[model samples]
Target chain A: GQQVMQIPQYQHVQEGEDFTTYCNSSTTLSNIQWYKQRPGGHPVFLIQLVKSGEVKKQKRLTFQFGEAKKNSSLHITATQTTDVGTYFCAGKKHSGYALNFGKGTSLLVTP
Target chain B: EADIYQTPRYLVIGTGKKITLECSQTMGHDKMYWYQQDPGMELHLIHYSYGVNSTEKGDLSSESTVSRIRTEHFPLTLESARPSHTSQYLCASTRGGSGNTIYFGEGSWLTVV
Candidate 1:
């Protein structure tokens, strides 16, 4: 079975502070995706990384995929109150079937 | 919006009752998925369908069964509901390749008494 683990199950930080969440997979992945879910809302796709050692950014958010496709990370610079939500990392196995998601890291930003 | 819709935003049913949660998407996406989640928690994939007549169970085992008779509709049914079945169920659909994003419905909150 394939498993994806996320570090820091929960996090709290002051506004404007930087935060990062790491995701690791027990098996190699064909592609990895990131998602965010606000309080009481369904998960929303943020970005997807397929190439090895790939890095992508959206405003204050930066995403990275490990060269071996076994791990990934999401970094938020200068966090804001709107950033309060659960960040999840998802990966597709070699079977190319469905996407498996991590437990997620809940981020709480305090002003 | 992505046009993914789920009926009965909230439901309360007694144990031993049979219930069905309806999911429909106008996006014409061939891929549909059903996931269960608790408040402020992780999403557990319960079922998914690549297209009509194609359904598969996910990592988490579920007591629910799903049907994909039409490309735009995928519904889940619980034969015997229990208190443990109380959770939020989300429906999603996606087009294009695996790289495409999944668009989710608001979700159906079910509570069995």
Candidate 2:
């Protein structure tokens, strides 16, 4: 079975600070996806990285996939209250069928 | 927003009672998944289906069962609920592909007393 490990189980920052969450998979992944879950709400898809060493940006957010395809990261710049939520990284191994999710990183931004 | 739907956004029942959480999607996705989560915690996949009449157990062991009679509907059932069953169940669906987006329903919160 494949497992995804995430770091900094919890994060607290000021509204203007930057935040980053890293994910590492036990096995090489074919693709990796990021999701955001608001308090009391279901998770919503944020982005996906397929190519090794790929980088994608969505406004203030940037996502990167490691060159080894076994790790990924999500970074947010100048966090705002609207960006408060749990960020999860899920990976699909090259030989696996099910997507394995990391224990998400909970982010809290204070004014 | 995705066209996925879930029933009884919240529920509370006594132990030993049977319960079913309904899920449906209009996106015509071939893959559907059921995940359980505690408040502000990581998601644990309990079950998934590739399509109608096909189901598979996920990484986490669950005491529940699921049926996929139609591509648009997938329901999870618990034969006998227990207090440990209290958690939020989320239903999600995605099209066939490696990088496809997963659409999730609002989720159903269940509590067994």
Candidate 3:
């Protein structure tokens, strides 16, 4: 069984500050996906990285996959109050399609 | 937005009662999954189906059972519910590939007393 671990279980940041959450997996992954869940809401698809050392960006958010494909990171630049939510990283191993999800990092942005 | 749908967005039942959570997707996806999530916790894969009549238990050990008679529908049933069963159950569907995106439904929040 594969395990995904995320750091900084909870983070509080002031507006305009930057925040980053790291995710590491016990096994190499075929691909990794990121999701965001707002308070009292369901998780929404954010992005996915398939290639090793791949980097993707959406507005103020940046996602990177480790060169070994066993770890990843999500960085938010100039955080806003709207960014208050939990960020999750799910990794799918080469052996199976099932994703091993990391215990997400809850972000609270104060204005 | 994803076309997946989940019934009984919230439910409260007594112990030993049987409850079924219904999930459907209009995307016509062949792979569907059921996940259990606790508040501020990671999502756990409980059950999934590769296609009709191909249900499989995930890494987590769940007492609940599921049926997949239709390609677009997957339902999870708990024969006897308990207080420990209180959690949010999310239904998701994908296009049957490792690189495809999984679309999740609104989720069913079950609270067994």
Candidate 4:
């Protein structure tokens, strides 16, 4: 079985501050996906990282995958009030089809 | 936006009652999944289907059962509901490809008394 762990279960920051959440897996992953869930809403896909040591950016958000494919991180620069939500990382093993999800990091921004 | 639909956005039922959460996706995806989530908690996989007549239990142990008779429909049924069963259920589907994005439904909020 594959397991994914995320750090900083909860974070509260002032608007325009930065935030980061790290994810680690027990085994190497074939691919990893990030998701965001707003208050009272379902999870929405944010980005997916497939190649090892890959870095992808979307607006103010930046995603990075470890060279070993066993860790990932999401960093948000100058967070806004609209960034309040829980970010989850899901990892898929090389030999499995199911995606094992981490507990997630909840972000709260104060305006 | 995804074309996935979940019925009964909210449900409040008494204990021992039977209920079914209906999930349907028009994207013709072969992979469908059901996840349970609590307030401020992580998403827990409950059940998933690869295709018609294929069903598998997820990492989390759940009392619910699911059926995949059609490619578009994957419904979860609770024969005897309890308070512990109260949680938000989300239905999602993926097109089955490398780096495929999963689309989730709005979710069904269930509360058992």
Give the worst 10-residue stretch by lDDT in candidate 3 chain B: B95-104
For candidate 3, write residues A1-111 as lDDT tens digits: 788999989999999999999999999999999999998889999999999999999999999999999999999999999999999999999987677789999999999
Give, for candidate 1 chain B, the lowest lDDT window spanning 10 residues: B93-102
Backbone clash total, candidate 1 = 0
Model 4 lDDT per residue over B1-113, tens place: 99999998999999999999999999999999999999999999999999999999998999999999999999999999999999999999998865688899999999999
Q: Rate the local accuracy (lDDT) of all candidates.
A: 0.94, 0.95, 0.95, 0.96
> DockQ score of candidate 1?
0.75
lDDT score of residue B104 within candidate 4: 97
Docking class of 3: high
- Candidate 1: the clashing residue pairs are none
Clashing pairs in 3: none
Worst 10 residues of 2 chain A by lDDT: A92-101
Residue B73, model 2, lDDT? 98
* Proportion of the native interface contacts kept in model 2: 0.85
Give the winner by lDDT: 4
Cα lDDT of model 2 by residue, B9-97, tens digit: 99999999999999999999999999999998899999999999999998789999999999999999999999999999999999977
Q: Mind giving the per-residue lDDT tens digits that candidate 3 earns over B72-98?
A: 999999999999999999999999877
DockQ, per model, reads: 0.75, 0.88, 0.82, 0.83
Candidate 4 has an lDDT of 0.96
Candidate 2 Cα errors over 4 Å, as ranges: none
